[model samples]
Target: MRTPAAALTGVVALAFADASIVALALPAIYGRFDTTIVGVSWVLTGYAVAVAVAAVTLIAVRRWLPTGPLTMGGLALFAAGSTWCGVAGSLGGLLAGRVVQGIGAAALLSGALELLSAHVGRERGRRLWSGAATAGLAVGPALGGALTEAFDWRVIFIAQVPVALLALVVLALSRAPALEPESGEPTTNPLWATAGYVSLFAGLVGALFLGVLLLVEIWRFSPLAAACVMMALPAGTIAAGRLTATAAPAVRVVGGTLALCAGLVGLALLPSASLAWAAAALFLCGAGSGVVARVLSPAAVPTSAPLVRSGGAVVAAKHAGLVLGLVVIAPLLAGSLTSGAEQAVVTGTGVLLDARMPVQEKLSLALSVRDTFAEAPRGAVPDLAAAVDTTNRSEATTAVVKEVDHRLSAVLTRAFRPAFLAAAALALLTVLAAFAVRKTPIGYPRWRAAPTAILAVLVLAGPALVAAEVAGGALDHGRYQETDPCAAPADPYPGDGVDALVQRVAYGALHGAACELGLSRERFLLALAGQPGFAGVEWDPSTVERTVRAAADRALDDVQQRGDLPGWTITLVRAAVRSMPLEELLRVVGLR
Candidate 1:
């Protein structure tokens, strides 16, 4: 009896330990897989979905099966899944393994709880499981992080196998009485409840997770800084968890869920991407999540009997929420942002390229185009260029910045609006789920609640306080901003004099309609020749083109010698010339 009880408790702890443990490992997983925010999130999603599915199914089927055999079978499945995850060659395989492990987790968690509830009185069962589970949850994140940082991420999963096998051994040796099923009105279908929770949570929490990640990644927040912005969630969860356990379980569950919905909607509608706004949403959602977990865990368990099924349903609901959150919400946000950015860039660039504009306007537009690229960092330019050509340096820089900012704002609006609205809807659904919760007696003793409250408060306040301090010193680190080691300001040397002289002749010819303007051998030839020509016919266009290019090259060389400017200026001029037709150069030169 002692062996079985001890083994079950250990198994339950192990199952839940992984949940929080992986939170800190998100960066490591992303690094190894070359995964983006959306893709990497599946590490949690896969596991959760699998657990949800198994939790409900295991509970529903437990009546027809032997309890010990079922528990052992679940453990074996979990072991296999863990092994597969550790050895997985690809991201897909690892995700699959996580799903498999989730199924086992669902069974193990449910079975263990039912066993505890059945062996202990309903009141004692709640107190014991809640106390143990809370402790495990608190320890998981720090322990997992320390281990991963010290050794390797693979060890995190691998470490679970031995402990599980040991639990299986204890279960096999113990002679425990069968956990009786609760006797009352017809039981609510575990599947229906699990599905509802999964859908609702996936839509709400998943969106928040993906949305915040993009804000951090694109906007250039450090991982720690980004995590700070996100800290509101866990804080809320801990605080609410402590407060609501003393209240009616149903009230906490239903009301907390509604709060979650409101929070999600709030996030979606937030006009600015400020950290405070994001944190507020996170706090509301986190509070709701914490409340729901506290409420649901107790409500799902049967006070009378069939502890296994009830426990399973609870675990299932939790994990299902995770799986749905990952698959559904992530893609919606990522796709919307990507599509919006692309469309805005294309439209803005096309408007500037219209042929009917005056020559000076066209020239101004070109300059703006180069400026766009110049203002944006090199890393961002490539993505921006996909919509507009960075082919022109001076004007492209500014144009890209305008286009990028517009696109980002548009996408953020498009994606978040729907996402927030959906969160509101999901919160409403949670309120509806609260109705499904049967009236069970509040189970924990008064003493347990106090400690739970204290711990919860500490957990909730720790990060929030630390983050407030850290954010005080934090730099904005926003998008399209320059970082360290910026390129030195442009230095035009004596060659710049050449470039100026050439420009003078070219402009003079255009302004005065001078044909065959004389080039200054050293200065004018050095500066102006390498540029692209305008569109039209040419009298001896090819000779003029060649002459201009040679002159530009010489000017760039002179600049390099006199002002310490690299030949990159000359190279750029050459590149521009290559793009222009010789006929266009002649036309600009007033030859035809």
Candidate 2:
């Protein structure tokens, strides 16, 4: 009985882990497929959608299905889908494979519990299944990161095939008693459970999805480093589970919801990229989630229904919550990022124009900085210091560069704060849902009821204040001093004919090449000039100008031979260089 139970539990763990294992790898996947963050999210969303649909459908027809065959079939399908995901060439193909994988996951998860219940008692079976699922969630990010770093993101999915197969073989040979039909109506309300699941899981998006992205893209942590930091969440969950085991269901639900709210609010108020602060907040979130899971999981699938149906409902509600969280949070994140970038640009320009350098030198530096901003990858904060030479320069140049870097970093930090606030709103909603739990009324005196009522009011008021702040945009100030600094500049090379044509060709080709290489124009130029054979090459303003002319000449020749470039390529070039500094034209035409 123990061996079969372990095997089935292993299957459950794998299925649960698959739901979030790819989160840390999202940026890598985005770069690989050359797609938008929203588009890459479908990789996660598609799997979740499939799981919700299949779990609900399976629940409606579990009576006609045999547990052994269903479990085996699901395992087999999972293996095939994993193979497809590994080999898929496009984003669409990967998403389709994920859907297939989700379907198999639904069957395996629902059937595994049913098999365990038949072999052991229902109480013991539920404990083992829940433990295994939590363990999987705990280890998923670390495992996914190790796999991705050791090989590639594709390996994370591909490596699961053998594990699923092993589970399949064990289930194929194990014997279990038939599942008895459940009696009586459900004691717990499924609607309330579903609502709670949505709120709780949605609240978790900041810690799991967006948090991972910020670590990798903004904080510049390696995947392995980010995974290590993320372990704080699961660690807290495990500890909280042990401590809350003897608590009443109502106590666990209400306390956990409040803890979650506190954690998200802490995250929103983060001052900087301090790992200690992040870890502490994540620990709170994990502990809260663990406690909430204790009350909510069983409630979602009442014992009155068939075990399979109950399990299916639970699975569907949980994954559906993940989908809901992403849908609401992704757009808010995008909007904040755009607003941040615009603010950064304005602030950076003000710093540049105020520098005490000659107009020509400042203009050259401005053009370089603008190009860097234009070519920065989505969700990445551009490093303005690298684009402009600050060291071994005039005092005024260094001061101005440092100020611009500081302002840009500040803007980026402010942008992500809103996402945390949005997540906090979700956590607050979870707290409200906790009120629906059926608690046994205590026979306390009327005086005690007044204190209890006051505590409840205080709890509700916290979230209300947070929501009011978010709606009122209270935090959106103090970053911008000037809206535009480079509105007009004296042209150093104002002319037409061949010089203009060459400048246009150079800018267009640079933009096109940067797109293809998945790097900013400044980074690409630095890389090109830093090749091994060119180790000792001088990189003064003249040398860089020469390199640009040569690259542009090559591009023009290629375009002339090819006859035309893509329409989008032309559009991208125009947009990129529309606000180019005056020195860029002079540099291109060798006019100093």
Candidate 3:
């Protein structure tokens, strides 16, 4: 009996988790369908809109639905929806299935609320229901990411079928909850409370939706890595569960909203692409979301009204917020990414032109980079590594490749700033919306806020200070400022690894070459990229080519004058100087 009860509970949790499970899958879906961010976002928006509509419609029919039959029926529908989604051949087909899934989700939530209340007491049942929903929301993205990384995005839908079926079987065999006639008005979903929900859920889109996109798409992290990084969000939420358990409901709502805003702001103005930094920001978001949801869910359910109808109102309000957030976020993100793509190309070009390699190599790199970005799908991190393949390159070229890749990643991070800020602005509105809950349910169970509330606020604020530089960035044009590569001297010979040895050998020759060219090592390196033909200045291939030939002639003369430089190193430099379609020159400086 307990096992059957547990299975039913798990089913309820699964239904709620389905709401945002696809966040991690969006990139895969977007790439697979070759759709725009706005287009793929419908994948989430469809579910939210359908669920909101279902929850609202279910409220009208709540009276006649029997708990046992409803639960079983909902599970069956859910299973069918999962099957449909799993087999979908097109985006439209996936959306059709999501609608079915949403309807099934509402039915299950309603049935589970009544059944659990009958099994336990009403208060415990409601608590269990709310807790499961938030837990599911918290865990959904990470779980989806793991599954997507391990398998295909389709598997997330396919996997749900068996769980739903098993729960349906257990439910069919279990004792039914007795439904009694209730005497009360069908509660009007409170306007103020609904508005608050709208704001809270809308704000959450920043943490759950945009946060994942930034991690996977912009940061170029694997879905699994992004999932692990985002665990901070759920962890914060779960931690806040106990921390805010006893605080005043109003404080939890308002304070939680503020924390979410701070986290979003941090995300918008991220200090770096480091996973640890992003996790710190998400932690505040998770904690705040958890605190608010727990307090808001039960508080929204009126005691005098039927539980299912009242619960439906809460679901409707929450999903309504999601739908609203998506509607706005989708378009804004699409435009931001579009503009960022251009900036990325410009930034990438500038980095290559300024590289410490041969002018001829710079010319070649420009072409490779242009082709790579052109071939890449919209919103993808173009594989810059491919643009500068180092498999067989000279050690000097390989070091340059690493620097180029790292520099591009840093520049790309800025491209996502505008979208993240938009999300933060949405979250900031939650503070105002939270105040609409003028009266929290009296005597309702609280997650004891205790001293943790103070600590949570302080922790959330910590990221804001670190991220203060975002304001400066937003005010400036997307033109990234890179330091003078020549300003810094080379490091000590790196570790004893193979790549390290290669760099050591390469730098030794580079130092010799710089001296041969009668220039500082940095100036020698910077000269090629600074050529007018390669730089943003008007093209002057004649002068740039002459400059390269002159540098090569001077280098050879100096080596002969010194009689100490390696002949092979000069041979490599001479080949690069003439590389532009004396195609045979490539063999001289070929990869090891």
Q: Candidate 2 clashing pairs?
A: none
> How high a TM-score does candidate 2 get?
0.72
For model 1 the local lDDT of residue 328 reads 57
Per-residue lDDT of candidate 3, residues 1-592 (tens digit) = 3665577678877887887898999999988875788888888888888888988888888778776787788889889999999999988899899989988887887778778767765666777777787778778899999999999899999999999998888777778556554454322235565567777778777678888888888778898998898789889888886677667666777778778777777776665667876887788788777877766765576545577777778778878888888888789877776666545554565566445555456556667665676678856777577655667566776666666665566656666666666666766666654554445464455345554456466445745545554643533424565333233234324354454444444444445544444554444444534632224333255543443445345445444444434778767766666665422323333511
Error of 1 at 212 (Å): 7.0
Model 2, C-alpha of 553: deviation from truth (Å): 43
Cα lDDT tens digits, model 1, 1-592, are 3666667777777776665556556656766775665777778777776777666676567777666667788898898888988888788888888888877877677666656656665556655665455445444554555666567778778888998988888777766665554555424333444444554455445434544444444444444455555556667767777776665545655566666665665565554446776677667677766666665554455365356665665566655655655565657655665554443344343344322333454556555554664566322322344434445544645454455455454344445455455546655666655665545444443334554454344335434543543354222211222111112122211123444444433333222221223322211221232222212224265645655554444444444444434577657765775676766755644644
lDDT per residue for candidate 2 within 1-592, as digits (tens), equals: 5778888888898888887889888878987887776787788788888988999999888878987888888889888889899999999999999999999999998888888887776766776777777667666776787777788999999999999998888877878877666565554566786578878878876678777777777666788888888888888778776666445556667877787777677666555555766676777778777777766766665555567777777788778877887887777877787777666665666566445565556767777776776687755666677767666567877677767777777666667778887887886677655655564212111223433343344345445544544464435422555422122112212345554444445444554444444444444444454522223445576765555544444454444444355756755654544445537755544646
**Segments of candidate 1 deviating more than 4 angstroms:** 1-10, 13-31, 34-42, 56-64, 126-152, 169-196, 211-232, 248-251, 265-280, 340-421, 437-582, 585-592
Candidate 3 lDDT score at position 465: 42
Worst 10 residues of 1 by lDDT: 481-490
Give TM per candidate: 0.59, 0.72, 0.76
- Please give the lDDT score at residue 449 for candidate 3: 50
Q: Residue 536: error of model 3 in Å?
A: 16
Name model 3 segments beyond 4 Å from true: 179-191, 392-396, 432-440, 445-449, 452-592
Q: Which residue window of length 10 is worst by lDDT in model 3? A: 583-592
On TM-score, the stronger of 1 and 2 is 2
TM-score: which candidate is best?
A: 3
